[model samples]
Target: MLGRTPLDAPERQQEVFAAVLGVLAEVGYARFNMDLVAGRARASKASLYQRWPSKARLITDALKANLPELPQPDEGTFAEDVRQILLAWGEPTPFDTAGIFLGLLEGSRQDADLACLREEHVDRAYTEHLRVAVDRAKARGELPERLDADFLITALISTFVLRSEEQGVIEGIVDGLLRPLIGTFRAK
Candidate 1:
């Protein structure tokens, strides 16, 4: 029987999560396994399995742990709030976020568990903050009464995720794209 030493320590768990991401970036979700994570983390496979029974569970937890802390700023104006959110979201991470997103996208296609986890943990993380911002805007009469919040949120998130790498992209998305789009939907 293997000891649960890695699971016992928070630092050790963080190391394991980093190892999981490293393995995921290298081999991707389809080929990711406990053995590879254990090898990278220097932990026992039994210990990892003891903590996270399924690949989906482990990967989802790892991704969640690694996600940047999103800011929830209530700037006076909706536009300013969105600008703050996008700038924070566009901040670079220590790891390859795009690679992880691609791996998750591929994994979610094949694993129902992963898909559900992605929706619950990953998607909600981004959408929930945006939802709150949108709600505040609606309350302030900044958005049209008939505006589709979900569609708008999706567009903003998709734009940030796709074009975050480019310099000044967030500013352009906010001022050039979103501001005009929101203007079109603003109460006349």
Candidate 2:
């Protein structure tokens, strides 16, 4: 959060994040060097590095910024909360997350630092985001307390892991499969 000091306002931080995401989406992670993002943001590499300790952190922050803040549920049903969480996978556009998932798993196998970030940042963000929705459901008495929301969250996201390459998942396959599992939590 402290990395984006370039602009005076929250919106300016968004501008920086957008520039970085453009580069990442266009160039992919390998070629998206700090200099390129700095050039786009019209800031120095020192500024970028000062804000984010590494390229991975920079990208992660950029991705985090681009997303709307976690959904706060007012919907009366667990089904709606679960749907919102599942629908995040289809938002904007879908990418081949399977490849990225495998790459992170394998890349972390060789690089301890990368593994640590993967474990702490990327993985945590996903789980915690899902947990927010799940927790809201529980508070509303929509989900039984016995359900392990953590495991269900993992399973929900996992539905898209292996098949993100197919591109048809966005249509409904993901939500279709996961809804049945999460639907059980709906308030009767």
Candidate 3:
């Protein structure tokens, strides 16, 4: 810790977060430190600590803040809703931090705090969103009433998150996996 005052400015927070992401992408979590982030962010190590309390908290929050918002569940047919939601991954965004995402995912296996942070923030939010979509489809008689929304959400999430390099690979996998579930749906 170098300075005692916490970071109060939105611009400063963004700056620090960007630096944190860039550095994490470069050196990874084990080697990531507040001093490096502070220097890169042109803030103080104390400021980082004062704001986030720990490296894991800081890193997780930064990653969470940078993550793009997931799509809202569509009220249309289950196929259209699933396709729109899953295919959104194929479109590129400036916030594509897949490398950082993967690195943290691997690191989360060994770091309990980081794992908790991820579970609380990233995974839980996405899971809830996916659950809502599946639940909605089920309510509309578009999906089987007895299906496990959590399992479907997990499958969809894992399929996309643990994807190959080929374009549309995730889309194809998600569609293949989800369509069968759709087929199991009862008619309205």
Writing each residue's lDDT as its tens digit, candidate 2 over 1-188 gives: 53445464677667777777677666655566789987887777787788788877776666565543455454555566555655665555333355455545554666577667766767776677668777777787766788788777767677666655556664454356545654654635
Candidate 3 residue-wise lDDT at 71: 85
lDDT of 3 by residue, 1-188 (tens): 43333466676677788888888877777888898998998787776787888888998888787766678767476666766666665567454355676668777987999999988987776676677777788788777777777777777776676673467765586467656656655433
RMSD for all candidates, in order, please: 2.6, 6.2, 3.7
Pairs of residues clashing in candidate 2: 3-51
Q: How accurate is candidate 1 locally (lDDT)?
A: 0.83
Lowest summed-lDDT stretch of 10 residues in model 1? 1-10
lDDT for 103 (candidate 3) = 68
Q: What is candidate 1's lDDT per residue for 1-188, written digit by digit as tens?
A: 23446476888888889988888777789999999998888888888888899999999998898777889999977788889988777776766666677788889999999999989988998888889899998898888767899998988887777666778877887789767867887735
lDDT score of residue 22 within candidate 2: 73
TM-score of each: 0.87, 0.56, 0.77
Assess the local accuracy of residue 34 in candidate 1 as a C-alpha lDDT between 0 and 100. 97
How far residue 15's Cα lies from its native spot in candidate 3, in Å, is 1.2
Q: Is candidate 1 or candidate 3 better by lDDT?
A: 1
How should the candidates be ordered by TM-score, best one leading?
1, 3, 2
User: How close to the true structure is residue 131 of candidate 1, measured as C-alpha lDDT?
Assistant: 90
Clash pairs detected, candidate 3: 2-46
Give the clash count for model 1. 0
